[model samples]
Target: MTDTSCIEIPEESSSEKVQQIDLLYKCISKLKEADRVLITLVLDEKPYEQIAEITGITENNLRVKIHRIKKELTEIFHKYARL
Candidate 1:
């Protein structure tokens, strides 16, 4: 899986943060409901084990799903950022 841990979102003021969140929700809205939930939990920084338990999947499988989800989100985010 690709390493995404090094990526950092810069901290911004409250107004900027709201705009960023709006963009995020717009991006996530394109995903399936399950994938939207997965991305939301991930952005919340929930641990892998907890996410696995909540999703009723094994940690390994959860990791794979998260990896794919992150990659998709990254693409969407970048696409939007360019606009």
Candidate 2:
């Protein structure tokens, strides 16, 4: 028998997802170029070491930056989400 336990399901409808994506992109666009690149790399699932090498930063710094970027992105996303 096939294992279905690992399968994931989405709670949002297609249109809601599209709208959320649109809002996310809008928020991302407002970020600085470096922040945009960093966030994109994270979203792409690049390893921390690789991301640090590419960004020329230490792993600890990268983690801190990622945390801050996410916080900023959340704020931006919420600001746009209300509109």
Candidate 3:
């Protein structure tokens, strides 16, 4: 016998989600075109191998680039969020 239970997931209000998404897009827009493309692919949940192939960069370089891009995006997001 197995007991089944439903776990409740907290949901953000649609308006709040929309605002956050708008802020994220604004942050992404501030990035260079190449960075924007790479981040977009990453956000789309593309695998690292496919991203590397698509961007013509090695996996190691891709990882480093992603780290930098995320750091930059976070800064940008925080800057705008503070306003």
Candidate 4:
């Protein structure tokens, strides 16, 4: 977090707000579906075994994917911050 920056969203109606949220989902839709799945499970604080069972993936693979997703998110933020 930095005091030198801030986020400002233009005032929008409720419907517009939903549209804005959908727009973000749409961007992720273009990304690998696996990453989306990883995000969903990780956000819920699910254990690796649970995520694996839900996704039918091996636990080790799930760990690798989660790590990759963290890196991906970091890059996504960096990409936006530079803009």
Candidates' C-alpha lDDT: 0.91, 0.93, 0.98, 0.75
Give me the runs in candidate 2 sitting further than 4 Å from their true place. 1-10
How many clashes in each structure? Answer: 0, 0, 0, 0
The digit string of per-residue lDDT tens for model 2 on 1-83 reads 99999999868998999988988888999999999999999999999999999989999999999999999999998888787
Clashes in predicted model 4: 0
| Decoy 4 TM-score against native | 0.61
Worst 10 residues of 1 by lDDT: 8-17
| lDDT, candidate 1, 1-83, per-residue tens | 98999999887889998988899899999888999998889989999899999999999999899899989988999999899
Ranking by lDDT: 3, 2, 1, 4
Per-residue lDDT over 1-83 for candidate 3, one digit per residue giving the tens place of the 0 to 100 score: 55546756789999999999999999999999999999999999999999999999999999999999999999999999999
Per-residue error (Å), model 4, residue 1: 29
Query: Each model's TM-score, in the order given?
Result: 0.74, 0.84, 0.86, 0.61
In candidate 1, stretches whose alpha carbon ends up further than 4 angstroms from where it belongs are 1-13
Candidate with more favorable, higher lDDT: 3 or 4? 3
Candidate 3, residue 76: Cα displacement in angstroms equals 0.2
Measured with C-alpha atoms, the lDDT of residue 75 in candidate 3 is 100
Q: Sort by TM-score, best first: what order?
A: 3, 2, 1, 4
